[model samples]
Target: MPDLSIQLLPGLKLKNPVIAASGTAGYGDEPNRLCDIADLGAFVCKGTTLKPRAGNPQPRIMETPYGLLNAIGLQNPGVEAVIEKYAPLWAGWTTPIFVNIAAESVDEYAKLAHRLDKVPGIAALEVNISCPNVAAGCLEFGSTPESAAAVTRAVKNATSLPVIVKLTPNTSDIVALAQAVESAGADAVSLINTLRGMAIDIKKRKPVLGNITGGLSGSAVKPVALAMVYRVAGAVKVPVIGCGGITTGEDAIEFLMAGATAVEVGTAALVNPRAPIEIVKSIENYMLEWKLTEMSQLIGAARR
Candidate 1:
């Protein structure tokens, strides 16, 4: 088979371009019992906050056609718990584990990153800027270029680990935001965090999600996600990690062609814990069938 290895970041490399999205994958240890954790390019742990959060009220998830809506509210144990609980476990695994961190303010992000700096097994840091369901200033940081850059800059200063800023799809110009983060010292950028969407229940006569609104992700958002990846890839110099509704190898190929150095599987993982491993196999088979030499050759292959 063709070499599937792709460099996700300048210094950070992966055996393949398939990674599990944060929040959906839980800790890297969750799926280790079901499949080989080493098979994935990387697994991002659930979003960790400054402190443990109960998350949004019940009915936090609702199924939609070919997609799902989630208002997870970044529920996670505090950063200390993450380092104490999962970091050691991850250190023993061969697959790189990127820690996804979320905070209400730039200062919070900085403090969290600083704490994680000394933790072992954390290969990288993914700043979660697109959390729409939080009541505090979570979404605000991602809604504007200045705030986005501010968070990126703060986190960059706090840690030497490779920083990948996760961008929210709720913004007006995602490309502009991507450029801003790149300029702010992001080693890479991941996009299409989640589309701000809502579901309504006629029988219940109210919103389906307890938060009234949630982030939409799944196969339904694939096209929008691919388009944004394509646009952002062209606009920024940093590598783009494409996410949002990716399920199959074909979907992954689409993102790779659009210029994503790697692809992240989210909701699919919830339905099947082995989804990312299957995706890695599927991509490998597809690469062989197409006689591709390296995964990087597929980047930006799609033309308008």
Candidate 2:
């Protein structure tokens, strides 16, 4: 195993640095047939809301050159349904399962967090503040420092479980937002949520995605994600979970060097459900090749 475990949050320890990102991994059960979910450091469930969302219309996804565009609209069965359906299954698993929640208002986020506070299967609550592909205030709460802090404070007050604020890349100053969340009592922070982008069909004179615009994610955004992670990691005292277009062990290493305590695989996992397992193996191999003892030693190694 090479002892790849790392401390992701103050009281949370992960077996490896590779975690499955929210929205990409469906409740840790969908990919079980394709890969071993227990091998992952953790699995972040799909974005849950206070109520069920049908999501955007059809053609919600479009493939770019080296990335993907999506407007899933946080389509989920709400918190109660999530607990009833997957909490029991997660309780039996060895790997930790973090529930990712999204909301239009701070009150909605607080209510959802309070509901999940006592759920035995959940290990943490990832507050998603950067969902740009939807209307009705998805990105409104995350784009500004004030709203971000307020949401963080509300969630922290409602739950004893660790709260990780998921940040968006569309902000003018991500470091400021990260610092604000930390000040507001976030246990940790994760970034960079998908970059806001849209694809247009010139030939058809229509947008490629059903929702005119969508968030872009994949290998193409790795460099931008790394820069944001580097800046945010230095700004916030809490741990940062890097996520964007990480697809390989090398990509994961880049994130670790940029100061991420752990890395989350999103778009890559869609291509290969076993990508996280491979990432874990690759990280171990890299550590062995470099004679490194712990993954923590690699964090912020690129800073120097």
Candidate 3:
């Protein structure tokens, strides 16, 4: 049998390399119901904030050709509520639970980290640097190396658990952004968050999404994600968790070969609840066919 397990970061080990992306997994409850959570590498819950956000109004999601456009606006319970309600359940699960956190300021980000630190159920923190820093005139923290590093430092100082900075593709230079967080003490990095995109209702003469603009994900973003993962992986020494449009074991293999230690499934799961588990099975099958003994032989194979 091939070994799918991976040490994603110091003290953050995954049984495999297929994590359920945030927003799609919904705190692992629904996905757990659909498939065994134990079969997944890790699970990232919806973006949590310091306070509960109502999120955007109606028509927050729309189906585009070959992709999904979502402006869910990070609707999630506050960190305190999450700990009180879900932490106990996560403590009992075998799979690692990563809380994807988003905030508008450095102080708020640190506070969320501090609040989640030492929690029994949470294994790590995936910082969503795509949130705009209110203090910086609403400039997204992931848009620049300096601001991204600042948030990373604050969060790192607040929590002892591994911090994986989630990079945004909307930035001017993604490689620089990844390097900045790595230098700021990030344990690992994940990319690329959905590309910024939107659609129009020609009949209604208006935008399809309620927010007018939303994040683009699914098959259409795979190539961009693959390129970003390959570039960021070469630029940093930490593990890279590839995400975007991974829908199959073959797609996951493409990312693993590009140097991502693991991959996160988002839109695919939305389309099919069992996508993550199937992806795991697919990887196992691929390993069997390739006669590979372990993940190291397959990971970064393309870079060579």
Highest lDDT scorer = 2
Clashes of 3: 0
Error of model 2, residue 272, in angstroms: 1.4
lDDT of 2 by residue, 1-304 (tens): 4678888876789989899999997887764677898889998999999998899987899999889999888889888899999999999999999999998889999999999998989999999999997787557999999999999999999999999999999989999999999999998999988998898899999998888999999998999999999998888789999999999999999999999999999999889988889999999999999989987679899986
What are the TM-scores, per candidate, against the unseen true structure?
Answer: 0.97, 0.98, 0.96
lDDT of 3 at 302: 99
lDDT string for model 1 (87-117, tens) is 9999988899999999988999999999999
Q: Give one digit per residue, the lDDT tens place, for model 3 in 1-304.
A: 9999999989677999999998887887653477788889999988889999888766988888889888888888889989999999999999999999988889999999999999999999999987322222113778899999999999999999899999989987899999999999999999988888889999999988778888889999999999999999999999999998999899999999999999999999988988999999999999999899799998999999
Q: Which regions of candidate 1 deviate over 4 angstroms?
A: 31-33
Task: Give residue 169's lDDT in candidate 3 (0 to 100).
Answer: 90
Candidate 2 residue spans exceeding 4 A from truth: none
Judge candidate 3 at residue 144 and give its lDDT: 94
Cα deviation of 262, candidate 2, in Å: 0.1
Clashes of each: 1, 0, 0
The weakest ten consecutive residues by lDDT in model 2 span: 25-34
